[model samples]
Target chain A: MNLRRLIVIGIPFTWLLLFFLVPFAIVIKISLSDPAIAIPPYSPTLELSGGWAGLKAFFSQLDFENFTFLTLDPLYYTAYLSSLKIATISTLLTLGVAFPMAYGMARAPEEWRATLMMLVILPFWTSFLIRVYSWMGILGKEGFLNMILLWLGIIDEPLTILNTNTAVYIGIVYTYLPFMILPIYSTLEKLDLSLIEAAEDLGCTRTSAFWLVTVPLSVPGVVAGCFLVFIPALGEFVIPSLLGGSDTLMIGKVLWEEFFSNRDWPVASAVAVILLAILIIPIILFQRNQQKQLEGDQ
Target chain B: MKKLSWFNLTTLTLGFAFLYIPMIVLIVYSFNGGRLVTVWAGFSTKWYGTLFHNEAFLDAAWVTIRVAVATATLATILGTLAGYVLVRGGRFWGRTLFSGMAYAPLVMPDVILGLSLLLLFKVMFGSMGMTTIILAHTTFAMCYVSVVVSSRLLSFDKSLEEAASDLGATPFDTFMSVTLPIIFPAVLSGWLLAFTLSLDDLVIASFVTGPGATTLPIKIYSAVRLGVSPEINALSTIMIGIVTVGVLTASLINKRKVVQRLKDEKTAN
Candidate 1:
């Protein structure tokens, strides 16, 4: 029994320790270390052969220079702020688009609900890169939207939608819509239909009952869905990089450019540390919400 | 029978249409004869032919499949074990930390994960390549698999395992026979999810991949960054087709299994 227990728990536990947990520790250590011009990029590799003085030297050498650099750079600050704003707005947009559809799916005849759920999940199974890439053709100046508008005689010239923040918003909402919809749909599906009837029977109109009951009950789903969308979208690199223009400022892109474009490992690690710090609250809330949902499921 | 009010119908239609139209447009334009991507031209299968002949794209795709397969297998094993431990291993040391590590990667942004892994690999392995990419993919993908499998195990009928235990089967034997069969479907779904994630990864792969080890998504990303091309459209169309078929087939099999189980329960009762 002990042997079985060890193998079952120890294998995965060790793997996570080595890979997931250890990597973040390395990131933190590297973030404190200084950038180097040598191979492997970061410097002051701690040497134990020289004993206590070497350790002291290493500790003294470790500095927050990279983190201070981050504070000094307006670019990083702006990118962080913009990423938050973009994530917020896109999450709200996803909620608006997904809630009604989730409602529709939940209210549909029972037989159709399964199929509708599959429809939402289908895109999730497909390559996310391809889904995001699909919008390029449609949102381009001479793309389908413009072509249709011109054919309808709405305008003589095509509007420039690609290479803009607006395009990022569209891509985010489109991509993350499923995440928002599924949770809301699950909550709505479990909703007691008799509650609505009871509300209507007790001098409430359909609209009033919906507003008071359906919307309020779905709040848990909404909150869960928002965190689901907001967390990833805040740190999004692909959508903003592909769709947004030069003016677009997102911390994920900044971190990518810092590491790859500028080859500054320490700085990139510092940026990542900060990003993770900001994400901690939302992540904790999300964890709590999911736990609550799981307990409710039980 | 209650019919959907027009509001629900309109919203559902519009919602699905919004979700689907972009891909449909890409599929339609993949056959365009002209060099331009957006404009309509004479339909042609030439681009698809061109895609088949592209050696670079083909090599990247092969690499992607190999990485995906390896990542999926490793992730499924580890994830299933993690799920089992979480659901049935009883309280153990560091359970909270273990569960946190297991679930954190699901929401972790790819860039930070990619960056952190790159930093670690540079320190430990010194050279990032296919091996490192697989390791990185498995690290995160296993988290997703654990979530799926553990959720299934959460709802599992535990009395079956207890029955096996009471019948004088060892705990290990009971787990292997009684528990494994019941959780097989969730385990399979987790494997599929991990496989798809590895296949679709670009960001993490980009961070860990060395020269000559580029995956398909990275190749496609660079190509797309160069601007939209008909060849890419053709590639995407094929990818979309594969995913559609895979998902539909999986769902159908699942549906059949559910029906069969229901029938079996009726007979047993």
Candidate 2:
């Protein structure tokens, strides 16, 4: 029985150790190496020499230069700061839009909740790139939104909504709305309505009761929703590249350019390592919240 | 359910409009007789024909479908094992690390994940290809699959397995007959989720793809970056149609199952 259990657990544990954990270790190792002009773009970690000399050469090659370079460069600093700014703003915007929709869905007739939930997730089921691509048609100079505004004489000229920070905000909020809504909706769905009703019966106005009762109860959902949106949006590459202007300097875009455009693999690795370090706190908090929720349920 | 208020109605209408108007516009213009995606010069389906005739696009689509299927299958098996361990392993050594790995990828930034995997592949294999892309996709997709399956396992009844073991069934036999059947639906849904995620991925695939291994999203992303056109719109419309049908069908089946369960309980009572 003991052997059987060991085998059952060993397979997945080993797979994750190799594929998941080892790859991350490689990223850290590569981040410590020097950038090179050759194929693979970073100085080789292993020397071709056999035995102790090769081991010595590998250890000698690793350094802190890439990380030091990132610290000295204003562009990298700006990218990191701007990414946090964009992610924070976008997370708030998504919450603002999603909270009402989720509240409505939770408060809807019980028979209709499933269909409503499905509708919220329906957009998510389609191709993410396609959904973002569709926005180009709607937000461009000659796009649908501009054309409608022009036809109505609302503006003398088309708004340059595409390829701008505004566009990035719109894209992030749109792509991540479901993430924000689903969590909040799950919490709201399980609320005992009588608590709100009881508050109202005690002469608390509906609005105040909502603020005092419902909002406090739903804090966990709000936090989870924000983390879900903020974490991914912080490193979002496709949306900013497709919709953002030249001025948009998100760290994800900067990392992509470093790796692909500039061929600076070492620098990209350093950027990734730094980004992951920044996120570790939120990641730990998110995990703790999940563990707490699981224990609460059990 | 509370009575629907004006606030609820307005929120629903406006929120859904914000969510869907762009796709609606894109689908409408896919049939535009004009070259511009936004301009309607009466309706035409020439772009659909053009999309079908594009050899590169077709090749990418084929590669994407194959990768998605492979990813879904492998991720399902690995993730099911991980999920089982998470809920049932009962204080095994290194269990915290196991659970953390299973859940971390759920929120880990895609760029970091992609870059880390790319570095790993370069060191190990010296090149990127479809195999590398499959490996990356399965790594993350399995995380999602694990979440789905583990949640289902959390609510699973332990007594059923105990009963089977009491009746002289071996552990494996009890799992095969009792636990597997009960969790099969969650596993199936996990496969579907993994498949869709694999199909939808672009950033990771771009980071890891080699020559001739371009996936559909990579192709569409590059094309859209340069400029927008109706052929891409037509392709998007077709994909949207397929996804819509798939989601609606799945939900309908799920609804029917729920209804059947309710009826069964009523009859038993």
Candidate 3:
């Protein structure tokens, strides 16, 4: 029985290790190698005939240039900072919009809860790319919003809303709002009503009771939702590329250009490594929070 | 008691409006008779007819369906295995590492993941195509399926399996007959989730797809770059309709099952 269990689990474990883990290792390895035309570029070979130099040539090529370029270059820092700023703002906006919606859903009568939740998730059925494209029609200069605004006499000219930071922000929040709401809803559903009642009985106002009892307990969900939105937003390529104009320089766009346009695999891999490093802190914190929750339950 | 504030109602209305207005516009514009996508030229089904005749759209749809079905099936199988391990396996060597590796794809940026996979294929396999795209989709889709299945597995009872084993059934037979049936609902849900995600993917598909392997999302993306058209809206509406029907049907069936189970439980009691 134990052996059978081991075999069942071992299949997936081995599969992931070979494909997922090894591919990443290969990326890191190639990132450390020299950019050359060889079969496996920068791999040191003893034979000097095949443009292969000794180990010294390989080690010497692996210098601080990649790391230095990421820091000293103005473009990289700008992209990194802008990506962080956009992600943070969008995450906050999504929270603001989602919290009340989720709260309303949670407090809604049981019969209505599922229907409301379905409404929230229905948009997600469409392709994410198409949904992003739909925003283009709505936000374009000659599109629906401008047409409606002009008819209503709200504005004389179309607004330049399609290709701007504002547009990217809208796109991110729209795409990720369901992610924020679902986690928050799940957490809120399990919250103990007695705690809020206790606060009310102790002479606390409704707002104060919420601030003291409700919000604190739902921190795990809030953190998880924020991580979900923030992390993806940081690496968002499609939304920013389609909605953002020249002004919005995100890391994902830069990475894409580096790999596809420049064919700079080493530099691109270096950028990926740096991006992975940036993500590690939040990933660790989120994992720790999950572990703590599990252990607390135990 | 404080009166219900107008502020809550106004915000709620605005929120729902923000979510629905774009979709509503898309649906309305799809039926517009005008050559221009934005202008109202009265209602017609011309765009929907145009969509039917567009061979490229049809071909891309076929490719997407093929990829989604293949990815969903393979990912669900692998994910169920992984979920079973996480719930039933021992704390053996590299267990934490395995679990983390399985999940890493979910949080990793699509651009990074796609680029890395592309680079790996170039270095080792010497090509970028459907096979690579399927593999990449499976990596992340399996993670979602595993998470779903494992959550269900956590609440599963083990004594049934133990009893089957003690009653002279082989371990494989016990799992196939007893354990599989119990967790079949979760596995089915996982498959549906994978199918939806695979259909919805664009970023990874763009990076890894080759000359002839373009998916529907990729086709829409490239077309949108030129400009929006009524045909695109028609396609979007069709996709939305299909998915809506599927989700509603699934929920209805689940509700029926729940009612039936309740009745059975009452009768047993």
Ranking by lDDT: 1, 2, 3
| Candidate 2 structure quality by residue, lDDT tens digits, A6-114 | 8989988998888889999999989998887887777865756658988887888788999999999999999999999999999999999999999999999988898
Q: Which of candidates 2 and 3 reaches a greater lDDT? A: 2
Question: TM-score of chain A for each candidate?
Answer: 0.98, 0.96, 0.90
Q: For each predicted model, how many residue pairs clash, with residues at least 3 apart or on different chains?
A: 0, 0, 0
2 or 3, which is superior by TM-score? 2
TM-score attained by model 2: 0.98
What is the DockQ score of candidate 3, to 2 decimals? 0.57
Error of 3 at B73 (Å): 0.7
* Ranking of all predicted structures according to DockQ, beginning with the best and ending with the worst: 1, 2, 3
Model 2: pairs clashing at backbone N, Cα or C within 3 Å: none
Candidate 1 local lDDT, A237-268, one digit each (tens): 99998988899999999999998899999899
Quality of candidate 2's docking, in CAPRI categories? high
Tally clashes: model 2: 0
**Candidate 3 clash pair list:** none
**CA displacement after TM-score superposition, residue B253 of candidate 3 (Å):** 0.8
lDDT of 3 at A75: 91
